[model samples]
Target chain A: MNNSEISEQGKLTIVGTGPGTDQLLAPAAKQALLEADSVIGYKTYVDLIRHILPESCDIQAYGMRQEVERSRAAAALALEGKKVCIVSGGDAGVFSIAGPVLEVISEEDLEKLNLSIIPGITSALSSAALLGAPLIHDFAVISLSDLLTPTELIEKRLSLAAEGDFVVVLYNPASKKRTELIKKCAQIMIEAGRKDTPVGIVRHGFRADQNVTVTTVSEMLNHDIDMNTTVVIGNSRTYRKGRFMVTPRGYAL
Target chain B: MNNSEISEQGKLTIVGTGPGTDQLLAPAAKQALLEADSVIGYKTYVDLIRHILPESCDIQAYGMRQEVERSRAAAALALEGKKVCIVSGGDAGVFSIAGPVLEVISEEDLEKLNLSIIPGITSALSSAALLGAPLIHDFAVISLSDLLTPTELIEKRLSLAAEGDFVVVLYNPASKKRTELIKKCAQIMIEAGRKDTPVGIVRHGFRADQNVTVTTVSEMLNHDIDMNTTVVIGNSRTYRKGRFMVTPRGYAL
Candidate 1:
C-alpha cells in the first residue's frame, strides 16, 4: 500500500455477485471479498453470500426504503479505514451500485481512499447466453424501473432500440408497481417493427428455478412475466429454429 | 471410473482461452482443461495454458487455415469418448470454434461426446473494461473483416450504430490489405452525429503493451490504428473532460 492507499485506510470495491450462485462469481471478486473489512448491501443480497464473509467482518444491511441511509453508513465505514465492499446482484457497474458508490466516493473522500469496480456476469449477457445467441449483434439494455426516470423517457429508449434493429434486454422489467411497463415496451416494439419478432423470457437466468421460454412480441404481451424475468426481444433478423433461439451476426456475404 | 464415467468418456468441453491471459480465464474453464483427455487449439493459444495441460493428454496444433480441419479432428476424438478440449481465444461462442464443433457433433454420438461451451472473457468486453466504460450503455460490436461479410454491409452496420447512439466497438478494424476501413468508420460516425464524439483506440487492451488513447471522431480518421486495436466510438453522452475519456451512464440519473 502506497501513500494514496495508506491515507485512505478505508477502500471501496463495488462488485457484481453474479446470478445467485457462488460458481458464477469471478475469481477476482472472490479474492476481494476476503480482503474486505466490512461488507454492505441490501439485506436480501447480503444473505446470498453471508456464508463466505469472514467472521470478523461487519455487515451494514439496508432495506428497500433506506437508500440514503445505507449509502451514508457505507461511506462512514470506509472513512474509518475499513475495507468496504458494496455488493450488488449481477455486475455492480451496471444499473446497480456503481453509480451510487462512485457518487458518494467523489463527494465524500476521493483523495483519501481507493475505489475500483469488479465486473461480474451481467444479467443481460447471462440471459442472452442461456437463450441461444440473441446478443450476437448490436443490442440495447434498458431498465423498466420508473422510480427515477419517467415512463416517457423509457419509451424513448425502447423506440430507439427498436428502430435501430437492436436486440433489447429489459431489466427491472416487471416490479409489482411497474407491471404495465413491460407490456407498454412490447407495444412500442411492435409498432416500430414486426409483431412476430422473437422474444425470449429468461426468468431467474443462471439461478435456481431459471425459466426460459420463447415467444413472439404478440404472444408475450398476453403472457405473465415478473420482476425476476429478463426479457430479450430480438431484432428484425432474429429467428427461432426448433428449440434453439438464434440471432444472426449480420448476414455474411 | 465407473461404467457411467466410461460411457461419458471422450467428452469434449470446449473452453474459451480468454483474450490473452491466465488470470482472466474462468475457474470452471481451468477445471475443464484439467479434466480433459485431449486439448486442441491454434498452436499459439495452447501455449498460454501449457503448464496446466496434462502430459498424458494428446495435444494437437492447427494453423490459420486449419481451424475447420482441427474441429473435425477434435470431434472425431470426442466420438471415441475422449475428453476433448478445443480451445479458442476469448469466449468460445463468439466467432470461435464452439459453434463450428457443435455443427459437427453427430446426433448418434451425442451421448459419447458431451459438448459444453465454457464462457471466457470476450475481447469486446475485455477491451471495454480496460478502457474506462464504453459499455455503460447500449452498444454495437462490428468486425471489420470483410472475409465473411461485404465491406458495404459492415459500413451499413457502422452507420446504424452511430445513428442509434451506440458506443460502437470495432474489432478487426484494420488488416494488411484493409488499411482505411477504420478511417471510413470514423467518417460515417461523424456524419451520423456530433463530430466531437470521443473515440478510443485500445491496442492489446488487457495485455502488457496496452495502449489506450481518446481522440475525436475527426481525429480518428487520420489517427494510426492497427488490427490489434479495438476502436470505441462513444454515443451522444460521450465526452472529453481533461485527460480521461468518459461515456457517462446518464450522469446521476
Candidate 2:
C-alpha cells in the first residue's frame, strides 16, 4: 500500500451508510471502508454495506442498545494502531456514532489520532427525493426520539417548526408503541398552521417499502405509520401535484 | 447490455459536484457521470469536473443565466435516446439546476422521461462540518438569491427562521452590490432572539481558502460578507467550545 493508505492503516474512518443503500454511500465512505482493517457497526447497518467490505476483513457486531459501548470499543481498538471503521446509518454525524466515538477518543486523551468522517445521505434528504421534493424549500429535520429528551420538548419543537412555516422532516416518527407522539406532532402542527397543509409519508426511505404517500395534515392524523416511515410536513407553499408532494423552495422559475 | 443499463442509456442523471472535491462526491454520482454519453452543465461547473468526463462524452456548454435553456437541451438530448448528465455544485437538488431541469422536463410534457437525482454534500453541511457541528440539531437553509423572486419573500423566510430558533444557514447571502441582505438577516435574527447569538461565517465553504469565523450577532452587524460566504447563525443552544462552533442536537452525556 502507498503512504496515504499506510497512514490510514492505524487510524479510524467513520463511514455513514446513507440510509442503508449501497448506492447512497459516498465515495469517501466506500474508500474508507475499502481501506479498513476491520469494520464495526450495528448489526443492520453492517449488513447494509457488507457487499463492499473486504472479504478478509473482520466484522464486529454490536446488537441493539449497545451503541455507546460499541463506539467506545471502536475507539479503543483504533488506539492500538489498527485501522477501524465505525459505521453508522444515515449521515454518521447526524444522530449517529461519530459524536460518541469522538467523545470517547477525547475522553481517553488520545492526541493526534488521524481520523476522518465519510458523509452519507441522510434518510431525510434521500426520502425527500423519493417523495416529490417536499424539501425543495427551507426545511427543518427534528428527530422525535425523546429517549434523550422529554416529550414536552419534542412537542414544543414541532410547534416551533410549524409556526416558522418550515417544511419539517420527522425522523423516528413512530415505533411499536410510539404512535401517540406523531399524532401529537400533527396536532401541534395543525394548531400552529393551516390543517390542509401537505404531509408526506416516506416508508423505508430509499430501501424496500419506499412507499411515498403525500397527504394532508388531517389525512396524516388519521393513520398509523411504522418506525420505517419518515413524516414530512410541508410549509405554507406546499401543494399536491397528482400523487407527487412538492414544497416550493422559494425559487421562482 | 443489461436491460437497466440499456434503459439508463436514454435517461438523465443529474450528479452533484459536492462542494468541489472529488473526495466529497458520492460514488453513485461519479458512477452516473462516468456512464453518461453526454454531459451538460455551466462552463465553470464543466471545468471543475472535466477530469472525470468520459472520452466518448459530448459536452454541451451553456454559459451563466442560460440554465432553463440548458436544462431543456439536456432533457431533449435524453428524449432523443442519449444519456444526459446535468451537473451542479454541492447537491444538485439543493439550490441548484436539478429542480429547474425537472421543472422544464415536466412542464414541457416530457412525462415518459426517467430522471435520477443523486444527492451530494451541500455547502451548508460542509461548512457546518468544518467547524465543530452547528447542525447537530434541526436547522433552516435559506438562499437570499432574489434573481427571480422579490427580496420581500426572502426576508419573510428569514424572519420566520429567526422566530423558529432553528440554526440558520444563509446561502447567496450577498453579491457585489447586494451586500445588505446578510445585514438584514442578522437584524431579523437579532430582533427575534438575543443579540449575542453566535454566528459562524464560512467563506468558500469546503474550498481551500475556507475561512471560518465565529462572532456574536452584534459583532457581525458591523462586518461585511459576500455571496460566497455561508453564514451560520446559531440558536439559543449554540455555544463555542474552543475554536469550534457547536449546537447541541439534544441533551448530551
Q: Which candidate tops lDDT?
A: 2
C-alpha lDDT of residue A36 in model 1: 88
lDDT of 2 by residue, A1-253 (tens): 6887666547877777786776667767788889888899999899988888889888997887676688777877787778889898877766667656655456333444557666667777677666655766667777788777578767776776776677888888888867788878878877876589988887777787567777889889666587677888888877765455666544445
Best by TM-score: 2
| Candidate 2 residue-wise lDDT, B133-241, digit = tens | 5766667788777776578867877776666677788888888877767778878877886588888887876666778888888888556578668888888878765
Chain B, TM-score, each prediction? Answer: 0.90, 0.90
Clashing pairs in 2: none
Give the docking tier of candidate 1: acceptable
Chain B TM-score of candidate number 1: 0.90
RMSD, model 1, all Cα superposed? Answer: 3.8
Give the distance in Å from residue A38's predicted Cα in candidate 2 to where it truly belongs: 4.1
Write the residue-wise lDDT of candidate 1 on A1-253 in tens digits: 6898676677877666777677666677778788889888988778878889889988777887454456567777877888888887776655566545444444337556566656666677567656655665556677787776567767776776777676788887887677788878888988986699999988877668788889999899666687777888888877775444567653321
In candidate 2, stretches whose alpha carbon ends up further than 4 angstroms from where it belongs are A1-10, A55-58, A65-67, A102-111, A192-194, A221-224, A249-253, B1-9, B107-110, B148-153, B190-198, B205-209, B212-224
Q: TM-score for every candidate vs. truth?
A: 0.84, 0.86
